[model samples]
Target: MNKKKLIVVENAIKEIAKRDGVTVEFVKMQMKIAMMNGVRSTDSKAKSFWDNISGKGKILTPEELIIHTSELVKQRKSQE
Candidate 1:
């Protein structure tokens, strides 16, 4: 992550720790749990996405497939 984003996350953790009267370590642990949950959710969504696309009964023409593939590539590149 970038420095500014890291600073924002650090500040958030500090605020949470202060509000809950907990140690920074405790806040960090909770953040870790939340991050792990997010990772799991992403993994599940990716699996479901592939499953939905994979079992499609209709076949595409070569041109159609190329267009679809290009669109997917563009989408992935934009996210990066």
Candidate 2:
């Protein structure tokens, strides 16, 4: 992690340790498990995303996909 994020995580762990009357090591272990679960969830989502997009069933050519993506960006900007 970057320095800023590391500091934030450390601060959070410290708070949790204080509130729960647990050692910093124990809080760190719980944080590690949470981070691992988050990584797994993100990996699963990305795999599903690729599986949906990478097949003969996907009809858009590269150029068409670019155009569609640009249109979606514009729509999002308008909504914002």
Candidate 3:
């Protein structure tokens, strides 16, 4: 990850860890598992959606998903 994204992810992980009473490493592992599951999903739409956001043959990181979603929300609000 780039410096900015790394910082954002670190802060987010720390907050999640504190609220959940878990270590930052645990949060990171969960995120990796979730991403891997998404990438390995058999459902066509699920796979396609991931491919769309992550690009073909690429795995999407937590931050990338957040960034994509934030951009989408901003676009929708601008259209309102």
Best by TM-score: 3
Q: Lowest summed-lDDT stretch of 10 residues in model 1?
A: 57-66
Please report the candidate that would top lDDT against the real structure: 3
lDDT of 2: 0.56
The C-alpha local distance difference test score for the whole of candidate 1 amounts to 0.56
Q: Kindly list the per-residue Cα lDDT of model 1 for residues 1-80, writing each as its tens digit.
A: 24564565567668878999998788766655653444345587744543443343343332333344456889999999
| Model 3: CA > 4 A from native | 1-6
lDDT of 3 by residue, 2-80 (tens): 6786687678879999999999888878987988888899999989878888898887667777667677889999999
Q: In model 2, where do residues sit more than 4 Å from their true spots? A: 33-80
Model 1 error, position 68 (Å): 27
Q: Candidate 3: lDDT of 19? A: 100
From the highest lDDT down, the ranking of the candidates is: 3, 1, 2
Q: Against the hidden true structure, what lDDT does model 3 obtain?
A: 0.81
33-65: candidate 2 lDDT, tens digit per residue: 653444345587744543444442344333333
lDDT to native, each model: 0.56, 0.56, 0.81
RMSD (CA, Å), candidate 1 to true, equals 14.5
